[model samples]
Target chain A: MRALCWNGVNDLRVETVADPAILNPKDVILKVRLSTTCGSDLHLIDGLIPTMREGDVLGHEFMGEIVDVGREVTKVKRGDRVVVPSFIACGQCWYCQHDLYSLCDTSHPKPELQEPLLGYPTAGIYAYSHAFGGYAGSHAEYVRVPFADTDCFVVPDGLADEDALFISDAAPTGFMGADFCNIQRGDLVAVWGCGGVGLMAQQGAMILGAERVIAIDQYPERLAKAEAFGAIPLDFTKVDVIDALKELTGGRGPDACIDAVGMEAAGTGLQHAYDRVKQALYMETDRGTALRQAMLAVRKGGTLSILGVYGLMDKFPLGLLMNKGVTVRTAQQHGQAYVPRLLEHALRGELTPAALATHRFSLEDSPTGYHMFKHKEDGCVRAVFAP
Target chain B: MNPVQSDNAIKAAARASVTIGRPADELRTLWLDPGTQSRIWTHFAEVNPLDGRTAEWLARGPAGGEYRWRSEAVEVGPDEIRWSSLDGADVPNTGQLIFRPAPGDRGTELHLEVRFDPPGGVIGEAVSKLFHIVPGEIVRHALYKFRALALTGEIPTTDPQPAARKGGADR
Candidate 1:
C-alpha cells in the first residue's frame, strides 16, 4: 500500500508500506478516499510536537469506505462510506460517556509515556506522533478504525467526499470552539486565523446565533474566504487588530474571541520575536501572539474559546484573565460529539467545507500536496489526497 | 542505647493519588475485585484471593524473578481499605488505599501509600535504584493504572499490535 511517511523535519515521502488490518474486535479497515492536510500537520512536519519517528505516517482528517470489519463491529460494515474522527476513543470510557472524547483514557496504547508529561494520557489520535498513540494515519491506502461502532460515522446521502472529509476534523473543531462560547442572541464573535478551522469556526459562530463574526488573519485569500462565509474580515497587517476589534465592538470588545491559529502564529512586535526565539530554542512549543490578542480583545466576563493547539506559552496573561472575569475554554476537538450536528448542517446547506478543499492530489503526489499546504502556496486552504 | 543500623534494614515509601471520575463506592468495588486488581496492576504475576479480606500475590521482582507475599486487610470500609503483609515475605510491605469525594461534583480522589523494607536494607535500595526499580515509580505507575482502569475499563498501552506495526517502507 502506498502511504506518505515523515522521514524527518521538512521531509515527507510516498512509500509502499504494509496495508492496515483490523487489530481489535471492534475495529474496521477503511480504504481511504479522501485525506486532507491540517494546520496541526504543519506543526508535526516542523518538528514542534515531539516523539515523531522516522517512517511514521502523517494524516488525520479523512473520510473513506469501510473495506472490512472485525467480529464485534456492528454499526458499520464493509462498503459503508464513513468518516472517522481524528481522536480515537472507546465509547465505554467515562470520558466518552461524558462526551469528553478527546480525554478518553483507554485509547492511547502507551499511557506511561504521556503520564509524566501531560499529567495523564489523552485519547489516541490517528497518524499523530507516538506520544499520542502511534496509530496509523488515514493517508495510506487502508487505515484501521478502532472502536468502530463508536468512532466511525456513516456519511449521510448526498454529501460528497469533499464535504464530509473536513467534517471529520476541521468542521468539528470549529463547531466545538463555537459551542464552547455558548453564544447568546446578538453576540459578536471574533476568530483568529482564517485557515480551514478558523473559517469553519466563523461559520459555526454565525450558525450558533452570533450576530456578527469577525475573522482575523494576514493572508488575503483566507480573509477573503472568511468574508465569503459572512464574517467581517480583519487583516492584522493593515490595521491594529486589538484597536480595530475594540472600535468594531464599540469599546466593549467582542463578546467571545476564538484563537484558531495554534503554535505557529505570526506576529509583528518584540514579544512575537521573543516567542519565535523561544520556540526555535525548544524552550516553548507555541507562539502565543494571536492568543494574547484574542485574550485582550475579548469583552470582560465574556468567553474566550481556544481551538488552537498549544503546548506552553511564556508570559501567559492568567492575571488579566482572572481580573477581567473571562471564561477560557479549550481542548482538542471531540469530533464524536459534533459530527452528527455537522452532518446535519452540511445536509441543510448551512455548512459547505468543500470550498476549503482548494487542491487535490493522488496518493503518489502527497509530498507535493503537503509542500503546497505547508507554504500556503497557490492559495491552497487544504490539499486533499484521494488514495 | 543506640541501635545498630543494619545494611539490610532500609525503609522506603511512596504516595500517589488520582481523581477518578466515579463514585467512591464504585471505585472501592473495582479496587477490591481481585480480577480487576490483577489486570490493572500488571506488575503482579499472580493474585489469588485466599479469603474475603486476604490475598496471596506474586509480584514481579528485579531480573525477571517473582516475590511472594500474603496481605491481610487490616481495616475495610466503604471508602478506604488498609492492608499489610503477614509474614515470610522477601521484602515486608504495608499499603493503604483511601477514597474521598472530590470537590464539587467531580468524583472520588483515590489515594495510595505504600511502604516497604528492602531485603538488603540500604544496599538493597541502592541495587534496586541501579536496576531502575524505584519503588516510588512502581507505586506511581500502579496508581495511574488503577485510575485508568477504574475510569476507562482498561489500562491504555501503546505496545504495537500486528495491524498497527510501524514497518519500514522497504518492507
Candidate 2:
C-alpha cells in the first residue's frame, strides 16, 4: 500500500509502504475510502514535530470501510463504513472512563504520565506520530486501528465518506472545542483562525446558539467563509482587532475567544520555520503569540478556550490574566465524545462540516494535497484523500 | 523603610514569576470570598459558573464556553485558598493560593500554581507542551475573578446584582 510518508523537516512524500493487517484480537483493518490533512499534520511536514521519523505515514483524520476485523472485534466488521478515532484506547482506564480516551493509560508504551500524545504506544492510526504510537496513517489504501470495538464508529449507510470523514477529527474537534467553551444562546463568541477547524468552530458556535460569532484571521478567503457562516469577520491585518471588537461589543470585548491558530500563526511575518522547529524540538516550549492575542481579546470575566495544538515548550503569561478576571478552558478533542452528536446534526443538515472539504486528491497525489493544504492554496480549508 | 516599597517588591516578584518559570506563578497571593467561591464551584447562574460545561463551551469559542472551579478555604499556613478542577483529567489539577505579606505592608501578593500530569506519552508530552501555552492565560483570568470577589465581595453574575462588599451597591 502507498502511504503519505513524512520525509523529514519540511519534506513529505507519498511512497509505497507495507499494507497494514489486523493486529490485536481487537484490531480492524480498514480499506481507506477517505482521509484528510489536519493542521497539526503540517507540524510533521514542517518538522516542528521533530519527534516523527522519516517514512512516518502522516494522517489522523479519516473514514473508511473495514476490510477485515480481528476475532474479538464486534462493533464493526468487514464491509462496514466507519469513522476511525485518531487514537486507539484501552476501554479500561481512568482517563477513558471520563471520555478522555486520548489519555488512556493502555494507549502508550512505558506509560509516561506527563506528556500528552494519542493512540496506542506501538501502533496508532496511519502516519501521525511515532512517540504517540507510530501507526501508519489512513492516507493510504489500508490502515489498522486498534481497540476497534470502541475506536471505530459505524457510519450510517446514507452518509458519504466526504461528509462523514471529519467525524474522525476536525468535526469532532470543532464540536469538542465549542463544548469546552460552554457558549450559550445569545452569547457573543469570537473564534481566531479561519482555517478548516476554525470554520467548523464558527459553525459549531452557531449551532450552540451564539448570537454574535466573530472570526478573526489574516486570510481574506477564510474571512469570506466566516462571513458566509453569519459571523462578523475580523481581518487582523486591516484593523486594530481589540479596538474593533470593543466597539462591536459596546466596550466589552467578546464573551469568549478560541485560539485555533495555535503556534503556526502569521502576524508580522511567518516566524522563520527553522527557528520555530528548533524551539519546538529543543526548548520544550511554544511561542504562543496567538494564544496571547486570544487572552487579551476575551472580555474580563469571560472565557478563553484553546484547541490549537501547542506542541512546544513556552512561557505562559499569568499576571496580565490576573487583572482580567478571565477563565481559560482547553483540551485535545476527545473525538469519541462528540462524533455521534455531530453526526446526527450532519444527518439532519443542521450542520455541514463537510463544506470545509475544499479540495480532494487520490492516495497517489497526497503530497500535492498536503502542499495545497499547508500553503492554503486555492481557498483550501481541507484536503481529502480517496483510495 | 517605607511600607509601600516592600509591598511593591512582592508585587514585582509575582509579576516577574508570571514570565520566567512555573514556580513563581505557583505561589499564592490573595484571598477569595465565599460567594465568588460558590459561583466558580457550584454554578450560581453567574457570568461563568466555572463548571466542566463552561470549559467545553469555551473550547467551541468565547461565545460558547463556560467554566466553574471547586474551591475551599484551606488551613494550610503557606497556602490560604485552595481550588481544584471540578472536571478532573488523568492527573488531578489543583491550584494553590499563596499570600506574600511584605514587612509593614498590609496588602499581600497573589500566586496560583496549576499542575496536571501530561496526557499520552512522549507524544503526549510534546502535545502537552503545546497546550501549556494557554493554561497560563486561563489561570490569569481566574485570578481576575478572584480579585473581583475580593474587592466587591461578589461573584460577577450574568445578571446584574448587588455587591456584597458595598451592602447593596449596584453597577
Candidate 3:
C-alpha cells in the first residue's frame, strides 16, 4: 500500500508499505478515503518535534470506510463510513468515562517513552510521533484504529466525505476550544491565527453564543476566509494587533482570547526574532508571539482558551495571567465529546469546514501536498489526500 | 526487548505500580487466578506453578540469553503477596505486591516491588537516561499494560509494523 512517510527534517515521501490489520480485539481497519494535513503536523516536519522516526506515516485528520473489524468491536462494522479522531481512546478508562478522551489511560502503548517529559502520558494518536503513541497514520491506504467504538464516529447521511473529514479533528478541536471558554451571551471572542483551527474556533464561538468573533492573521486568504465565516478579520501586518483588538472591543479587551497559532507563531517584531534564535539553539522549545499577544489582549477576567499545541517556551507571563484573574484552559481535543454534535452541525449546514480543503492530492502525491500545506502555497488551508 | 545477560551480574531493584478501578478483593482474585500470568505478562517471563506456594520462572532476553529461577511465596493475604527466589537460582529475586483501597473511591492502589540480581548492569540492560530506574521503568510500563488488559480487555502494542527505513525502501 502507498503511504506518505516522514524521512527527516523537512523531508517527506510517499512510499509503498505494508497494509494495516486489526491489532487489537477492539480495533478496526479503515480503508482511508480522505486524510487531511493539520497545522500541528508541521511541528514534526520542521523537526521542532523530535520524536518522529524515519518512515513514520504522517497524517491524522481523516475519514474512511471500515473494511475490517476485530472480534470485540460490535458497535459499527465493516462498510461503515466513519470519522476517526486523531487520538485513540479506550472508552472504559476513567478519563474517557468523564468525556476527557484525550486523557484516556489505556490507549498509549508506549507510556515509558513519554512518562519522563510529561510525568504522565496522554492517549495515543494516529500517525503522531512516539510521544503521542506511534500508531500508523491515516495517510496510508489502510490504518488501524483501536477501541473503535470509542474513537470512530459514523458520518451521518448527507454529510459529504469532504465535510466529514474536518469533523474528525479541526471542528471538534475548535469546538472544544470554545467550550473551554465557557462563553455567555454578548461575549466577544478574539482568535489568533486564521488557519483551519482558528477559523473553526470563530464559528464555534459564534455557535456557542458569542456576540462577535474577531480573527487575527497576516495571510490575506485566511483573513478573507475568516471574513466569510462572519468573523471580523484583523490583519496583524497592517495594524498593531493588541491595540486593534482593544480598539475593536472598546478598550476593554476581548472577553475570551484564543491562541490557535501554537508554537510556530508568525510574529512581526524583535521578540519574534529572539524566540526563533532561542528555539534554533534549543534554549527554548516554542515561539510565543501569538500566545503573548493573546495574554495581553484578553480582558482582566476573561478566559484564555488555548487550542494550540505547545511544548515549552521561555518567558511565559504567568504573573500577568494571575494578576488579571484570567482562567486558562487547554488540551488536546476531546473529539469524542464533540464529533456527534459536529456531524449534526455539518448536516444542518451550520458547519461547512470543507472550504478549508483548498487543495487535494492523491496518496502518491501527499509529499507534494504536505509541501504546499507547510508553505501555505496557493492559499492552501489544508491539503486533502484521497487514497 | 531485554538485553543479553552479562557474567558480571549486578544487584538491581525495580519498583512499579498502577491503580485499577476494581476493588482490592477482585484484584486479589485476578492475581491469584492461574490464567492471569499468561493474560497480562505476555512476551515477558512465564511463571509455572510448581507446588502450592511456589512457581518456576523462565525469561529469555531478546539477545538470546536465558534466565531461570523459582520463587517461593513467603507471605500471603487478601491484600498482599510476597515472594522470594529459592537459593542457588540463576537470578536471586524478591517480589512483593500490595493492594490497598485508593482514596476517593478510585479503586485499588496496586504497588509492585521487585529486587533482583541481574546478569547485566544498567548500561547493557537498558539504554535509557532513566537507567537508574531502567528495569523499574520497564516494570512500570508492564504494569500499565496489565492495567490496560484489566480495564480494556486488551494490551496495546505497535510492533512488527512496516516503515520506510533510511536507505531501505523507495520513497
Candidate 4:
C-alpha cells in the first residue's frame, strides 16, 4: 500500500507500507478515499514540532468508506461511508462517556497489547505524528479506526468525501473552540489566524449566532477565505490587530476571542509550554504578542479559547491575564464529540469545511502537497491526497 | 497473533508505580489483589444514562469480557474500598485506589491513583515525561468515573472493552 509519511523533520516521502487490517473486534479499516494535511502538519514539516519521529504518516483530517470491520464493530460495517473521528477513545472510558473522548484513557495504547488496536499508530488518530499520538494516519491506502462503533460516524449516502472530510478534525475543532469561547447570538467575535482551523472557527461562531465575525491573519489568501465565509478579515501585517478589533467592537473588546494561531504564532512558539515550567518567566516582546493581543481583544469576563497546539514557547504574561479576569479555555479538539454533529451539518449543506481545501495530490505526490501547504504556495490553505 | 505472558511478569507490571518510590516488581505485593483490581475495572466500565447509544455499549462486556459486575465498600476508612471484579477484566496498570470520605454535607470522595513506572534507565525518564499527569488530574478521572457509575448505575456501552485492532502494534 502506498502512503505519504514524514521520514523526519522537513523530510516527507511517499512510500509503500503494508496494508492495514482489522485486528480488533471493535476496529474498522477504511480504504483511504480522501485525506488532507492539517496546519499542524506544516508545523511538523517545518521542524516546529520537535517530537515528530521518522516515518510518521502525516494526516488526520479525512472521510472514507468502511471497507472492513472487526467482529465487535456493529455500528459501522463494511461498505459503510463514515467520517472517522480523530480521537482514539475506548468507548468505556470515563472521559469518553462525558464526550471528552480526546482525553480518553485508551488514547495511549499500551505497548503491551499483543493484538493491534484499531486506528493509526499514535494515541488514537489517523495520521498525526508521535508527539500527539503515534496512530498510523489516514494518508495511507488503508487506515484503521479504533473504537469504531463509538467514534466513527457513518456519512449520509449523499455526502461527498470532499465535503465531509474536515468533519473528522477541522470543523469540529473549530466548533469546539467556538463553544469554549461561549459564542452567543449577536456577539462580536474576533478570530486570530485565518488558516483552516481559523476559518472553521469563524464559521462556527457564525453558526452559533454571532452577528459579526472578524478574522485576523497576515496572509491575503487566508484573509480572503475569511471574507468568503462572511467574516470581516483584518490583515494584522497591514493594520494594528487590537485597533481593528476594537474598532469593530465599538471601543470595547470582542465578546469572544479565539487564538487559532496557537503556539505557531512566529516568535513565541515555546512560551505556553515554557511558562508552565517557570513562574514569572520573561518573554521576548514579539514571541507571545498574539496571545497578549488576544487578552486585550477579548472583553472583560469574556472567553478566550485557544485551539492550537503549542510546541513550546519562551515566556508568558500571567499578570495581564490575571488582572483581566478573562476566562481561558483551551483544548485539542475532542473530535469524537464534534464529528457526528458536524457531519450532520455538512450533509445538510449548512456548513462547508472543505471549502478551504485548495489543492489536491495523489498519494505519490503527497510530499509536494506538504511542501505547498507549508509554504502556502499556490494559495494553498489545505491540500488533500486521493489515495 | 496473541502470545501468553508468564504469571510472574504480569504480576510484577500490574503493581508497578514509579512515583510511589517502589520498584515495578514490588507493586503487586504492596497495593493490589483480585478484589481491588476488579473494583477499578468496574468503576472504569460503568455507564451513564445521559450518554445515549454509547451507554449501552459500556454496560455490555467485550467478547473478551465486558466490565460486567463488581461490588465495592469502604472497610477501614471512607477512602478505602474493598472491591471485587466478577466477570470483567481487572485493572492491569496499577491497583492502589485511595478513597477519602466526605466530612460534612459533601459526598464521599474517592481517589484512584495509578502511578506510572517507566522501564529501567533513561528510557523510563522519557516515558514519564511523555505521560505527565498532575495529581489532581489522576484523582479527577477516578472520581468522575465513580460518580458517573454511581449516578447511572450501569455501564454506558455494550462493548466496554473496545480494542485497538490494526494499528495497536505499529507503535
Candidate 5:
C-alpha cells in the first residue's frame, strides 16, 4: 500500500508500506476514496506541534469504501461507502453520551502521554501525534477505523464522494462552531479567515439564520469564495477590520465572532512579526492576529466562538474579554455530533463543500499536493488525494 | 509516618483502579477464569492453571527478559481474590484484586495491588530494574486492558500497524 508519510519537518514522501488490518473486533478497513489536506496538517509538517514521529502517515479528513469489517461490527458492513470523522469515538463513554464525542474516554489507547498536558486525555484522533493515540491515518490505500458501527456514517445515495469528504472534518467543524453561537433571529456573525473551515463557518451562520455574515481575510480567492456564498467580504490587508466591522454594523459589533485561523495564522505588521520571530524560536506556538481581531470586533456580551486550535498565547486580551462579559466556546471538532445533520444538509443541496477541493492528486503525488497546500500555491483551499 | 526506615527495608508496591460498566459479581465471574484473565492481559503475562489452587505464570520483564513463577491462590471471595508465590519462585510477589460496587450505578470499581521486594538490598533494586522485573508496569497494563475488555469487549491497540521507521527501506 502506498501512503504519504512525514519524514521530517517540511519533508514528505510517498512510500510503500504494509497495509493495515483489523486490530480490534469492532474495527473496519476502508479503501480510501478521497483524503484531503487540512490547514491543521501544516502544524505537523512544520514541526510546530512537535509530537509527530518520522514515517507517520499524515491525514485525517477522508471518505472511503469499507472493504473489511471485524467480527463484532454490526450496524456497518463491508462495501458501505462511509464518511468517517477525524476523531475516533467509542460512542459509549460518558462524554460521547453527552454529545462531546471528542472527549470519549475509552478510545485513546495511550492516555499517560497526554495526562500531564491536559490534566486528562481526550479521545484519540487519527494521525495527529502519539500523544493523540498514534492511530494510522487515512492517507493510504487502506486505513483501519475502530468501533466501526459508531464511527462510520454511511454516505447517502446520490451524495457524490467529493460532497461527503468535507463532512468528515471541515463542514461539521464549522457547523459546530456556528452552533456554539446560539444564533438568534436577525443576529449578525463575523467570521475571521476564509479558508475551508472559515468558508464553511460563513455558510453555517447563514443556514442558522444570521441576518448577515462578514468574512475577513487578506486572500482574494478565499474572500471571493466567501462572497460567492453571499457573505459580505472584508480584506484585512486593505481596511481597518475592527473599525470596518463597526461601521458595517452601525457602531455595534457583530453578535458573534468566529476565529477559524489557528496556530499558523498569517498576518502583517509588528505584532505578527513578533509572533513569527517568537514562533521560530519555539517561544510561543500560535500567531494571534485573527483571534485578537475577532475579540476586538465582537460586541459587548457577544459570543466568541473559536473554531481555531491554539496552544498558549502571550497577549490573549483576558482583561478586555472579562470586562465585556464575552462568552467563549472552543473545542476540537466533535464531528460525530454534527455529521448526521451535515450529511442531510449536503443531501438537500444546502451545502456545497466540494468547492473547497481546489486541487487534486494521486496518492503517489501527495507530497507535491501537500507542498502546494502548505504554501497556498495556485490559491488552493484544499488538496484532495485519490488513492 | 515514620521517616527513619532502613534502606531497602520497605517493599515496593503499585496500585491501580478502574471503573467498569458491569456488575461486580459479573466481573468476578470472568476474572476468576485463568484463561479469560490471561487473555485479557496477555501483554503482561500468561497464566496456566496447574491445578485447583496453583498456576504457572510466564511473564516478560520490562527490560525484555523472561521470568517464571508459580502462584498459589491463598484466599477467594465473591468480590475479592488474593494470591501469593509458592516456594522456590524466581520472582516472589503477592497480589490482590478487589471488586466493589461503584457509586450512582456506574458499575463495579476494580482495584489491583501488587507488592514485591528486590532480592539484594539497594544493589538488588538496580539489578531488578536492569533485569526488567517491573511489577508496577505489569499492574498498570493489565488493569487498563481489563477495563477495555470489560467495557468494549476488546482492548484498544495500535499494534502491527504501519509506521515508516526512520532509515527504513521504504523511506
Candidate 6:
C-alpha cells in the first residue's frame, strides 16, 4: 500500500507500507476513497507536535468504504460507505457516554508518554503523533478503524464523497465550536480564520440561529468563500479587525468569538515577531496572534470558543477573561456527538463542505498537495487526495 | 535492642493511584479478573488464578528473563485487596490495592503500593534502571493502565504491530 509518511520536519514521502489489518475485535478496515489535508496537519509537518516517528503515516480527515470488519463489529460491515471521526474513541468510556468523545479515556495507547506533558492523557487520534495514539492514518489505500461499531458512521446515500470527507474533522470541529457558544436568538458570532474549519464554523453559527456571522482572514479567496457562505468577511491585513468588529457590533463586540487558526497563526508587528522568535526557541508552542485578537475582540460577557490546536502560549490574556466574566470553552472536537447532525445538515444543503476541496491529487502526489496547501498556493483551502 | 540493618538493603517500592469513574465493587472485580490483569500488565508472561484468593504469575525481567512468584490474598473485602508473595518466590514482594468511594460520587479512588527486593539488592536495582525498567515507573504505568482498562474497556497502545512495523515495504 502506498501511503504518505512523515520522515522529518518539512519532509514527506510517498512510501510503500504494509497493508492495514483488523488489530482489535471491534476494528474495521476501510478502503480509503478520499483523504484531505487539514491545517492541523501543518502543525505535525512543522515539527510542532511532538512524538512523531519516522515512516509514520500522516492524514486524518477522510472517508471510505469498509472492506473488512472485526468479529465484534456489528453495526457496519463490509462494503459500507463510512466516514470516521478523527479522534479514535472507545464508545463505552465515561467521556464518550457523556458526549465528550475526544476525551475518551481508553483510546490513547501510550498514556505514559503524554501524562507528564499534558498533566493527563487525551484520546488517541489517527496519524497524529505518538503523543496521541500512534494509529495509522487514512492517507493510504486501506486504513484501520478501531472500535468500528462506534467510530465509523455510514455516509448517507445522497451525499457525495467530497462532501463527506470534511465531516470527519473540519465540519465537526466547526460545529463543536458553534455549539460551545450556546448562541441565543439574533446573536452575532465572529470566527477567525477562513480555512475549511473556519468557513464551516461561520456557516454553522448561522445554521444554529446566529443572526450575523463575521469571518476574519487576509486571504481574498477564503474571504470570498466565507462571503459566499453568507458571512461578513473582514480582511485583517487591511483594516484594524478589532476596531472594525467593535464598530460593526455597536461597541459591544461579537457575542461570541471563535479562534479557528491554531498554533501557526500569521500576523504583523512586534508581538508576532516575538512569538515567532520564542516559538523557534522552543519557549512557546503557539503563535497566539489570532487568539489574542479574539480575546480582545469579544464582548465583555461573550464566550470565546477555541477550536484551535495549541500546546503552550507565551502571553495568554486570562486576566481579561476573568475581569470581564467571560466564559471560555475549548476542546478537540467531540465528533461522534455531532457527526449525525452534521450529516443531516449536509443532506439538507444547509452546510456545504464540498466547496473547501479546492485541489485534488493522487495518493502518490500527496507531498505536492501538502506543499501547495502549506504555502496556500493557488488559493488552495484543502487538497483532497484520492487513493 | 534494635536490629542492625544491612548497608545494601534493596527496597524498591512505589505507590500510585488514580480515580476511576466506576464503583469500588466494579473496579475490584475488574482488577481481580485474570484476563483483565494479564491485559493490563502486558509485560507479564502469565497470570494464572490458583484459588479464589491466590494467583501465580511470571513477570518478564530484563534481557528476556522471567521471574516466578505466587501471591496469596492476605486481606480481602469489598473495597480493598492485599496480597504478598509466598516464601518460595524468586524475589520477595508484597502489594496492596485499595478502592474507596471518592467524595461527591465522582468514582472509585484506587490506591496501589508495591514493595520488592531484587535478587542482587542494589546492583539489581541499578541494572533494572539501566534497562529502563524502573520499578516506580512500572507500578505507575500499571496503575494508569488499570484505570484506563477499567474505565475504557481496552488498554491503549502505540506499540507497532506486525502489519505496521514493516517500514516502507510495499505489500
DockQ of each: 0.27, 0.01, 0.47, 0.05, 0.44, 0.41
Better of 5 and 6 by TM-score: 6
Ten residues in a row with the worst lDDT in model 2 chain A?
A: A110-119
Residue A20 in candidate 1, Cα distance off native in Å: 3.5
Best by DockQ: 3
Per-residue lDDT of model 1, residues A1-387, tens digit only:
888888787888888777666656778889999999998787678665566777788899999999899897888899999988899988766678889999986787655556666777889998777778778788888888888888999999999999999999999999999999999998999999999999899989988999999999998999889999999999998999999999999998999999998764221112433455464754243347788888888999999999887764556889889999999999898999999989999989999899899999998999999999988999999999998
lDDT (tens digit, per residue) of candidate 3 on B1-171: 334333222325567778888878877776766566555544457778765578787766655666788888899898899889998776677878899888886888899987666435433244222223356664687678778877888888876455776342322
What is the alpha-carbon interface RMSD for each candidate? 4.3, 27.2, 2.5, 10.7, 2.7, 3.2
Kindly indicate the candidate among 4 and 6 with the higher lDDT. 6
Worst 10 residues of 3 chain B by lDDT: B124-133
True contacts kept of each: 0.27, 0.00, 0.63, 0.00, 0.53, 0.39
Candidate 3 residues lying further than 4 Å off, grouped into runs, are A264-286, B1-11, B39-54, B60-63, B118-133, B166-171
lDDT against true structure, model 2: 0.63
Q: What TM-score goes with each of the models?
A: 0.83, 0.65, 0.90, 0.69, 0.88, 0.90
Model 1 residue runs over 4 Å out of place are: A264-287, B1-11, B19-38, B43-110, B113-117, B122-134, B143-154, B161-171
lDDT of each: 0.80, 0.63, 0.81, 0.62, 0.82, 0.82
What's the CA error at residue A9 for candidate 1, in Å?
A: 1.8
In model 6, the Cα lDDT at residue B107 comes to 87
Candidate 2 ranges beyond 4 A from true positions: A110-126, A264-287, B1-171
Candidate 4 per-residue lDDT, tens place, A81-107, comes to 778767777656456666777766445
* lDDT by residue (tens digit), candidate 2, B44-162: 11333334222211112233433333333333565355555444443334556566553332234566665433333323233224333334434454554454334323332211111
Q: TM-score of the second chain in each model?
A: 0.77, 0.41, 0.71, 0.32, 0.78, 0.78
Worst 10 residues of 6 chain B by lDDT: B1-10
Per-residue lDDT of model 6, residues A222-249, tens digit only: 9999999999999998999999999999
Task: Please give the range of 10 consecutive residues that has the lowest summed lDDT in model 4 chain A.
Answer: A111-120
Q: What ranking emerges by DockQ with the best candidate at the front?
A: 3, 5, 6, 1, 4, 2
